[model samples]
Target chain A: MKYVDEFRDPAKAKALVKEIAALREMITPHHQTPLQLMEFCGGHTHTIFRYGIEQLLPDWIELVHGPGCPVCVLPMGRVDDCVALAERPDVLFTTFGDAMRVPGSKKSLLQAKAEGADVRMVYSPLDALQLAKKHPDRQVIFFALGFETTMPSTALTVLQAEREGIENFSLFCNHITTVPTIKAILDSPDMRIDGFLAPGHVSMVVGEQPFRFVAEHYRRPIVITGFEPLDILQSIWMLLQQMADGRCEVENQYARVVPSRGNSPGLDAIAQVFELREFFEWRGLGSIDHSGVRMRPAYAPFDAEKKFAVPKLRITDPKSCQCGEVLKGSIRPWQCKVFGNACTPESAMGALMVSSEGACAAYYNFGDLQELLQRREKEAIPA
Target chain B: MCLGIPGQVVELIDSEQMMAQVDVAGVKRPVNIACIVDEHHPPEACIGDWVLVHVGFAMSRIDAGEAARTLAILAELGDLQEEQAAMHEGAR
Candidate 1:
């Protein structure tokens, strides 16, 4: 806990809170609307709730959770395609632990596994390749899904498979990019994001150069943030300082993990294996152009999309679900009608409720402290 | 699922394959070091060096000095009167 424990120090957190307050005051009079800052990463969202960071902030500064949770944004149609591949008797489907619970149009991958499909959970793509080596007769399919953070490993695993001549292993590539998604969010009609707490992991892979447009085009300040408590608090403080200084730029608070220029070998592997798709569908957000990546033609032998006859169906978000609004920062997660009552984590009716990193799930799990604080505020008001 | 914890390299299980064992918060596990060992940047990963481990792969090598600097900034900024005031309110 050398790197972690120091980031969660209460004394440091207290100081950051004090600094954030003084900075928030500088921007308070400039705008009629609240100073809404969006943390554009689910990891940041998780840390904020886990450490009760929101409670330390003043009411004038509102933290809006963005659509950073990749699992939560995975369309039901894609899940259904995964189910289709898993149900094949000759195929052995593998995915991460959290992806098992994500519901398809009909059922989740867990449900498919329970019903006797060869759906397996793997810690990495190499493990899936190992499974393919073990079962030479069966087709091994890795349900690859994530941002630039996880892309390199999958690309390298595919490269390894090709080198070893592992004929039966392939990838169900749902790999997406972060820059286009951020652009999509910024282009949305109701976007009120004053600044951003950029995703550290993705930035570590793609670097801060990809996020220059957020500052250059949109004129919003973004601080690439770490996933620890003090990291979140310090990042929030950094964003506030930028607003106070009347400057819009991309800054790195998690400079320890993120370099100005990112991992080269990882980016090289990604360039070798994947190409941007024309448009890809997100669960809550609609089709974003050049947002998703597909396996290149050279690696077509390892592309699962061509190998299996998937039901390429487009499914809309549920009628009652306000995940789009929540993702867009137009509304808070709790304001959704189905939030706690109809769409708890146990029985997720929307995409946000499916993943722990999702805004709705984070709210359901750790947002009670803020809720209680709000309740006490309402009670204190003269009636 | 983008949880990359900083773990120290404990052992090299398969150096040719760039696979090594890293200890993350005391739990040791085998991880691929290929991504971090960029051709442009010489592979300096050795036993005892800290790397950011994400999904059984070493994403990047973490600089200890940079990590210390970040921690120092947080500590220095945390010294505030408002924070002291908030703590005093809690004491009451």
Candidate 2:
């Protein structure tokens, strides 16, 4: 209770809310309406919805979800690639538990595991290393995923495997970086982001350096926020202040966990293990040039692509699913055709509903949000 | 990607395995010391030491000096004033 109790202090929470409301009042007249802010982390998106932050906000301020869920944005082909690798004989595929239910092209990892594939859920890359040690003869493949914050762990796995001469271990690298994906989203024709609530975990590894590209070059205000309710509220206040001042800069709101240099030891472990891929495909965002890391050639023996021979396959996203539009921040989840009736969590049509962090799932699980939304819609229309 | 959470090490009691309990905002979680296992510290990493934990591993020990610096800034900024007072204070 040492760390958590202090950060979650109710008095501090009330103070942060008070601070945020004041910040909102400062920018009240700027837009003639509420400020349209986008929180660009899936974790932050989940927390906001869970805590009913949407209801707490002033009517003029809007928080749109961004494309940051690594599991949700994982391309159909990559999921299929993981499925194929899992199916291979004498192969044990490992991934974070959240990914098991994510619908790939034909089947989810959970389905493949149900069919007797050795798909083990791991909390970290180190867990996969232990699996490799246990199964000396069988090939151990860790489905590496996430933004820069997570890449260091995967990088460590590869580095440790090489250092220990673990021949049977390899990485099916789908490790994506956050900045490039943000740039791609911003560069798109539908760019209307007034401010950004940057991701905390990702910033912990990449530091505050790359994000300056979005702030300075793109002329946008961004505050890197943590996942907690108070953490997010404080960040929103900081971002709004930047907008009111007519200034744009990268600011670290989650300073307790993040520093200017970041976790250098974690950074070194990754740099030693992996390098950039020319391009990698994202689920909703398509392929961004050089946005991810593949295992370096020196670690070729530990590359799952070479070990399992998972064939290249073209997998299209569901045509009716609006996950693409939602992920691109061009449309809201409610705008999707199959949101409540058809694409409920149990019968998820896309990856967005699979993870708790998915905006759609977050919207579904928390309180009577969907019903409230319906009530509002009915009242708004003239009878 | 590795999402490292900042937690305070509660005790190094599990000194032999280089394992200890860390409190993340109040959640008591067990972490391994594979990376930062100190023999002198044993199973006891010490209570109230803030550490960066990744994937159940206590990767690095945080410096108290840095934490003091942060808290000093928060105090200097006067993080707790009435809403308007806080805004005016934060803006400066």
Reference-based lDDT, each prediction: 0.82, 0.72
For model 1 the local lDDT of residue A334 reads 81
Write candidate 1's Cα lDDT for B1-92 as tens digits.
47665667888888777888876545566778887775554444466677876667789788766434433443433422322232222222
Name the candidate that leads on lDDT.
1
Model 2 spans with C-alpha error above 4 angstroms: A1-15, A23-29, A367-383, B1-48, B59-92
How good is the docking of model 1, as DockQ?
A: 0.22
Q: Tens-digit lDDT track for model 2 on A174-245?
A: 888788888887888876677899988777777789899888899889998976677777888888889778
Q: Give the TM-score (vs. native) of candidate 1.
A: 0.89
DockQ of each: 0.22, 0.13
User: For model 1, what fraction of the real interface contacts is kept?
Assistant: 0.47
- Show where candidate 1 strays beyond 4 Å: A1-7, A369-383, B39-45, B63-92
lDDT of 1 by residue, A1-383 (tens): 12333444677877778888776558888854668889988878876776667777888878898888889999998998899899999999999876999988899999999999999888778878888999999999999989999999899899989988999999999988899998999999998888899999999999989999999899999999987678888888888788788888999998878888988888999999999999999988889999999999999999998877877877788899999898888888887767887788998888899998898998888767357446545755798
